[model samples]
Target: MIENYIATHLIDVAALAILCYLIYSNNILNQNRKWPFYIGIMLTVLIISSEAGTIIAGNANGDLRFLNIFCNVFGFAMSPLIPIILLAIYDVNILLTNKLLMLPSIVNMFATALSPWLGFVFYIDVNNHYERGNLFIVFVTAYILNLIILFISTVRTGQKHHYPIKAKFTALSLFVIAGTSIQLIFPSVYSSWHSVTLSLLLYYLLLSEFDGSFDALTRLHNRAAYDKMVNRLDGRKLYSVIVMDINNFKEINDTFGHDFGDTVLKKVASVIRKSFDNSSTCYRVGGDEFYIISSETDPVKLEHQLKCMTNNLEKERKNDGRLPTVSYGYSIFKGGKGIGFQEVLKEADDQMYYFKKIQQDMKKSTQTS
Candidate 1:
C-alpha cells in the first residue's frame, strides 16, 4: 500500500513539474495577466493535495489532511478553466462580458476554501486517510460544467476562426473534455490519470502551435500562421491587412551578397516587430516580402501606422543613402466585408506594383535632370 501510494505521488509531482515547465517555456504565462495566476493556482492546489493524500494514506490511516482531498477535487475541477481563459486571451473580444462563464471556477475555489466547515467535500478520521463524502456530487457537477464550457468555447472559437493553430487546440480541448467526462463517470479508475494526460497533451499542442505559426529567423509568425488568421473572417471586426515588400531586394542580394540581404531582412522584420502590438501577428512570406495583418481594423489607426513606417524608411534612406524602401498597399475591411482574402492580396499586390512604378519614374526623371 505504501509503495503504491509513493508511486502515485511521484507521478503526480512529475506531472506538476512538467506543467510548470510548459507554462514558463511557452511564454503563455506572460502573454495574459490572469492566465498564469489561474493555471499556477490550479497546479499548486493539485500538487499539495496529492502529496497530502499520499502522506496521510501512508502514516495516519485516513485521519488527517482531509482538506487536501477537497483541494485536489477543486483543483482538478477547475483545470478546464485554464484553456477557456487562454482562448479568451487569444480572442480577447469574445468573452469580454462573460463573467458568468467563470462561475464554475469561482464556485470550485469557494468550495475548496469552505470545505472544512461545511464538510462538503469529505471528512477524515485520526488515521490521516479519507473517503469521499456526499458533497462531492456538488463539486463534480460544477467541475463538469466548467469542462463543458471550455469544450464549447474551444469548438465555437475554432469554428468561428481558422487560425493555423486552432485545429490543434480544438482537438485537444475535445480530448480534455472527453477524458474529464470519463473520469466523472468512473472516478475510481479515471480521476488520477485525467489531469496528467490532459496537461501533457496541452503542452504538446502549445509547442506545435508555436512552431507552426512562428518564423524561426525573425521570430514572427510564418505564412501558414497568417493564412490561419485570414481564413477566420467575421464581418464585424475592424482591421486592415498590410502587404509590404522591400524594393530592389534582389539587387541587394546580387551586389552585397545573400548574407547582407539576410541582414536587411532581419532589420526589416525587427522594425515591423517593434512597430506592432504584441498581439499582432507578423509573417515573412517571400524573400523580401512581408505581411502584417493588423486586427486593429480601424482605417485611421492603420493609415497612421503605415504612414509612420513609410516615413521612417524614407528618413533612414536620407540618412544612410542605402536603406531599403518598402512598397506597401493596405485594404480596409470596409463594413467588415471584402471580396475574398486572396482577392485582397492580389489587389494589394497590384497597388504595390503601381507604387513601385511611380518610384522608378521619379528616379529616372532625377537622373535625366
Candidate 2:
C-alpha cells in the first residue's frame, strides 16, 4: 500500500519541489507577494503527504488508528483550502474584499475537526479502517464552492486587467474543476493533487510568458507584442490602428525628471486602457509613444474612444497642472484590398506628426502673442 502511494505521489511532490527551486532561483514573484505562492506550495506538499499517510494507516492495526483519524481529518479539512490558496496567489485582497468567501472553508474545517468525535464528516472504525459519515457531502460541497469562487475570480481578474491571455486562464480554471470533479465523482481515482500540481506548473509558465510581453513601466503590451499581433492579423478582418505621442514629453522629462515622466506615462496608459473595450489591444511601442489596435470598424465608435481618452487626460491635467496632452491619429484597414499593416501604420504615423506639428504651431503663436 505504501509503495502504491509513493508511486502515485512521488512525481507530484518532486515536480513541486523543482518548481519551488525555479521560483526561488529566478525570483519570478515580487518580494512582497511571494508568501502566498510559498504557502500554496507548502500546502500542496502537506496535503499530498497526509494523503499518503491516510492510505498507509487505513490498513494498519494497533495504535495506528489515531494516525488514520488524524490523516483523514487533515486531508478533509485542508482539501478545500487549496483553491482558496490559489485564489490568494492570484490576488490576496480577494478574500479580504469578500469576507464571506472564507465562510465555507471555515465551516468545513470545523466539521472535519469534530468528525473524530461526532463522526459528522468521517470516522475511523475499531479495525483502523476509514469510513465516510452521513455528512461527507459537506466536504464535497465546500471544495466545489471554493473551486467555483476561484473560477469566477480568475475570470473577473482577467477582464479587469484586460489580459490578452484571458482565455488561457479560463481554460486553466476549467482544467482544475474537471480534475477535482472527476476525483470527487470517483473516489477510487487519486488524480486530484497530481492535477493541481500540473495546473500550478502550467499557470506559472503562462504567467511568466505574459509578464514578458508587457511593458514594465506602463503595464501595457510592449513593442514585441505589438509586432507579433500585427503579423498575426487576419487579412479578411477589419482593423483600426491608432498611434499617440505625448506632447512635450521630452521637455517634461528634462524639466521634472524621469520619475515624473514615468508617472505621466503610467497615467496616460491607464486612461488609454480604460477608453477602449475588450476588443482593443493597447501597446507602449516606444518612449512616450503608444499604439492601439481595435477590431471595431465603426468610425464613430473609434472617434468616441479617442474623445474618451482626451477627456480622461483632461481630468489628469486638472490633478497635475504640468501634465501634458496627447496627440493621436488613426487609420482603418477595410480588409484584404492588398493593404498591408505597415501601410496603415505609416498613414497613422504621418497623421499623428501632422497633428503634433499643428499643436506646435499653435503653441508658438500663443507664446509670440
Candidate 3:
C-alpha cells in the first residue's frame, strides 16, 4: 500500500518540476535577465531525488537504505531554498547589482551534503528495502521552514518591484507551500491531482510574465508597460522623439480594407524596429501613427538617418507599386529650451503635417502638369 502511494507522489513531483523548468527556460530565451535558471535546475534535481527516495521508502523492506534516507533528507530540505533563489532573481534591484542574494543556494548545497548522518531517516538491508525512523521529523521540519522563509521573501520582493503579477505569484507560492505541507502531514492527499494543481498555477504565472511587457500584434512594448519604463528614466537624460504618420491612412483603410491596413502598419513597425538601435522605444500611438524615442542621438546624424529612411521607404513603395507615403517629424532636446516633453512632441507634429501638406501639393502639381 505504501509503495503505491510513494510511486504516485513521485510522478506528480517530477511533472511539477519539469513544468517549472520550462517556464524558467522560456523567460531566459526572451532575454529576461532577472530570472535565474539555476533555481529551476536545482528544484528539478531535488524533485528527482525526492521521487527516488519515495520509491525506495515504499518498495524496500527491513531497514531504510542509505540512498533512500539520503534522498528524503536532502529532497525535502532542498525544496524551499529553490524559491528563495527565485525571490532574489525576481527582485531586480538587488539582483542587478547587489551580490549577497546568492547565499541561499550556497547554504542549501551544504545542507544537502550533510544529510546522510541521520541514520534514523534511512536504514537498509540486503533486499534494498528502506525503513523510516523517528528523525523524519527533522527533514520535514527543515523543508517546512524553508518554504515559509521563501514564501515571505517572494511576497516581499514582488511588492517591492510592484510587479503586476505580484498577487498571482504570492497566491501560487502560498498554495504550493500549503499543498506540500498538507501532503506531508496527511499522506492520503498525496496524489497526481496535487501535482496538476501546482503545475497549473506555475503555468499561469509563466504566461503572465511572458506577456507582461509586449503587445501581441506589433511585438512592441504596450502603452501600459511603456509608461512604467518612462516613469523610471532619469529626467536629466536627453531622449529625442520622432513621430511619423502615414499620409492618407484613412483612405488606404477605406480602399484596401482593415486587414491590409493592419499589414501596412506592421510593415512600418518592422521598419522602425530594424532602423533603430536596441535602446530605442517604438510605439504605435494610433492607427497609422508611430512614436520612436532614442536617447543621446546626434541631431545631424538623426536627420540624415530620417532622410535615408524616407528614401528607402519611397523605393519600397515604388517596388510595391503603392501610392502611400510615410512622413516623419522629430526634435532633439539640447536640454535648455524649457520645453516639456508634450510641447516638443506638439512641435514635431506640426512639422510633420506641414511637410505632409507640401508632399501632397507637389503630387497634385505633377498630376496637373
On lDDT, the candidate that comes out on top is: 2
Q: lDDT of candidate 1?
A: 0.62
Cα lDDT tens digits for candidate 2, 1-369:
568767879889999999888777654344444577778988999989988887778767857999888888889999999889888877888988999999999999999999999998998888887778889999989998998898788778766555556678778878988888787778667778988999889877876665667788888889888888887887778889999999999999999999999999999999998888887889999999999988887989999989998998999899999999999999999976778889999999999999999999999999999
Residue-level error in angstroms, candidate 1, position 103 = 4.0
User: 272-309 in candidate 1: lDDT tens per residue?
Assistant: 77676643567888678898776776767777777777
Task: Give the 10-residue window scoring lowest on summed lDDT in candidate 1.
Answer: 28-37
What lDDT score is found at residue 283 in candidate 3? 73
Question: Top model by TM-score, which number?
Answer: 2
Candidate 3 local lDDT, 1-369, one digit each (tens): 666755665666666666556666664234343245445544654665565565656466636565565666565556545555554444445444644544544454555455455444344445665444455565555555555555566556443333345566667666666766676666545532454346354634554563565565676556676567557545577878788898888998899988878777777667666666544677766567777777736887788667766776777687775447788888766575566777767877888888898999999999999
lDDT of each: 0.62, 0.86, 0.61
Using all chains and alpha carbons, the TM-scores for the candidates as numbered come to 0.56, 0.88, 0.53
Give the lDDT of residue 64 in candidate 3. Answer: 55
Give the clash total for candidate 3: 9
TM-score of 1: 0.56
RMSD of each: 7.8, 2.7, 10.2
Please rank every candidate by lDDT, starting with the best.
2, 1, 3
